[model samples]
Target: MNRRPLPQIVLGVVIVVVGVVGLLRAMGLVDLSLDDLFSTWWPLAIILVGLAALVAAPRAWIGPTLIVTVGLLFQLDNLDLLDVAVGELLWPLVIIFVGLSLLTNLGTRGTDDRTINSAVIWWGSARRTTSQQFEGGSLSAIMGGIEVDLRQAGLADGAEISVFTFWGGVEIKVPPTWRVQVSGLPVLGGWENKTVPPADPEAPVLTVHVTAIMGGVEIKAGD
Candidate 1:
């Protein structure tokens, strides 16, 4: 699997463009001043991050899109271009969005749940499934935490899993020999894969699809 960070690339372009625009203004080649441009356009950086997240993983785009909408509204309000108070709308919209998100697909989700071993948690904090031979399963941590240790586990060539964390976090421990692929959209959150690639260079691939909102997911080398 291609491990290139697409979001980083997009963000780099945005930063470069903004810096170049500011330089042009300073050189008297543009109409707007540095302050005016920064104040009026800097919020776009946040919106673009959300957009990149949505593009990276469409399956869980709502969280990122909500973040984008809120940011845009706030920026407009700050620029005196909006009449209504966007702040008042934030909490209500967040509640509604969370409700809809849960109702839509809050299952023991995976590429194929019925065919794999798994563990899922909704609230509080706990974990399970210390399988010695894990073969691709879903792990969810919502408004809580979870830890999965699969150091001794085994996987087939194309095994995959989906992890969703909302206002929560998850930690995964995997064997060093596994070839892992991590993909996700993070809204006020992060997804990090710290597992080292095996020296053999022909390890089995384990694809992890994730959705993170106000939370985080991490993968670490184990055993």
Candidate 2:
């Protein structure tokens, strides 16, 4: 029972459903077409993705929450339930959400251990990790950037760093002796790992799990 497998499962189901509907339509068994269905209900997909992200990474809820909000607004507009245009209300709602997120620390939680939990919204941030027992931590950036210097940190075992970025970037600097493994989804965005692995196969590993939407992440070895 992995905590993050639901997203993948949901994606698989969506693909299967689309294929089945397409096949049924081609056979004249269904009146609805995929294009029409998607055009009318795409916002629901965004909301579902956001919900999955929340389940996948509860601590990094800032991006997911915003996504859910946007999806709801779009859906409401599609249904003609609002008095004003969604475009007119979107930015104001975003600003309000950002304010609330700042006050609530964007759902980031502090731990008693040396685990970094940071959130940057509409601003840039720079931090350095010097923890001797660096466990993993979560980092969230929305409409901002975060530069984390972890060269001074000593990883006793392995570490897992979760990063969520929306229209922002995150740069991580690691020690050359460490090995880096990065995995995650990026929508209209990407990540780059420029760490040259040391010859020792037993080098400590640092795993980065990221969710980036219209954002980027870069990791490299630094002094």
Highest lDDT scorer: 2
Candidate 2 versus the native: TM-score? Answer: 0.75
The deviation in Å at residue 92 for candidate 1 is: 0.9
Clashes of each: 0, 0
- Give the C-alpha lDDT of model 1: 0.67
Off by over 4 Å in 2: 1-9, 12-16, 19-29, 55-57, 76-93, 100-113, 156-158
lDDT against the true structure, each candidate: 0.67, 0.78
Residue 30 Cα positional deviation in candidate 2, in Å, after optimal superposition? 2.8
How far residue 204's Cα lies from its native spot in candidate 1, in Å, is: 2.5
Reference-based TM-score of each model: 0.65, 0.75
Which segments of candidate 1 are over 4 A away from where they belong?
1-4, 75-83, 108-169, 175-177, 183-192, 199-202, 209-216
lDDT tens readout by residue for model 2, 1-223: 3343556578668879989999999999999878877888889988877776666556677778888989999998888887888889878877876676566444433222456766778888776767777777777888899888888787868678888888899999999989998776655776899999899999899888777778998999985
Which model scores highest in TM-score? Answer: 2
- Candidate 1 least-lDDT 10 residues: 110-119
Q: Write the per-residue lDDT of candidate 1 for residues 81-134, one digit (tens) a residue.
A: 988898788878767765765554455543223323222334443333444445
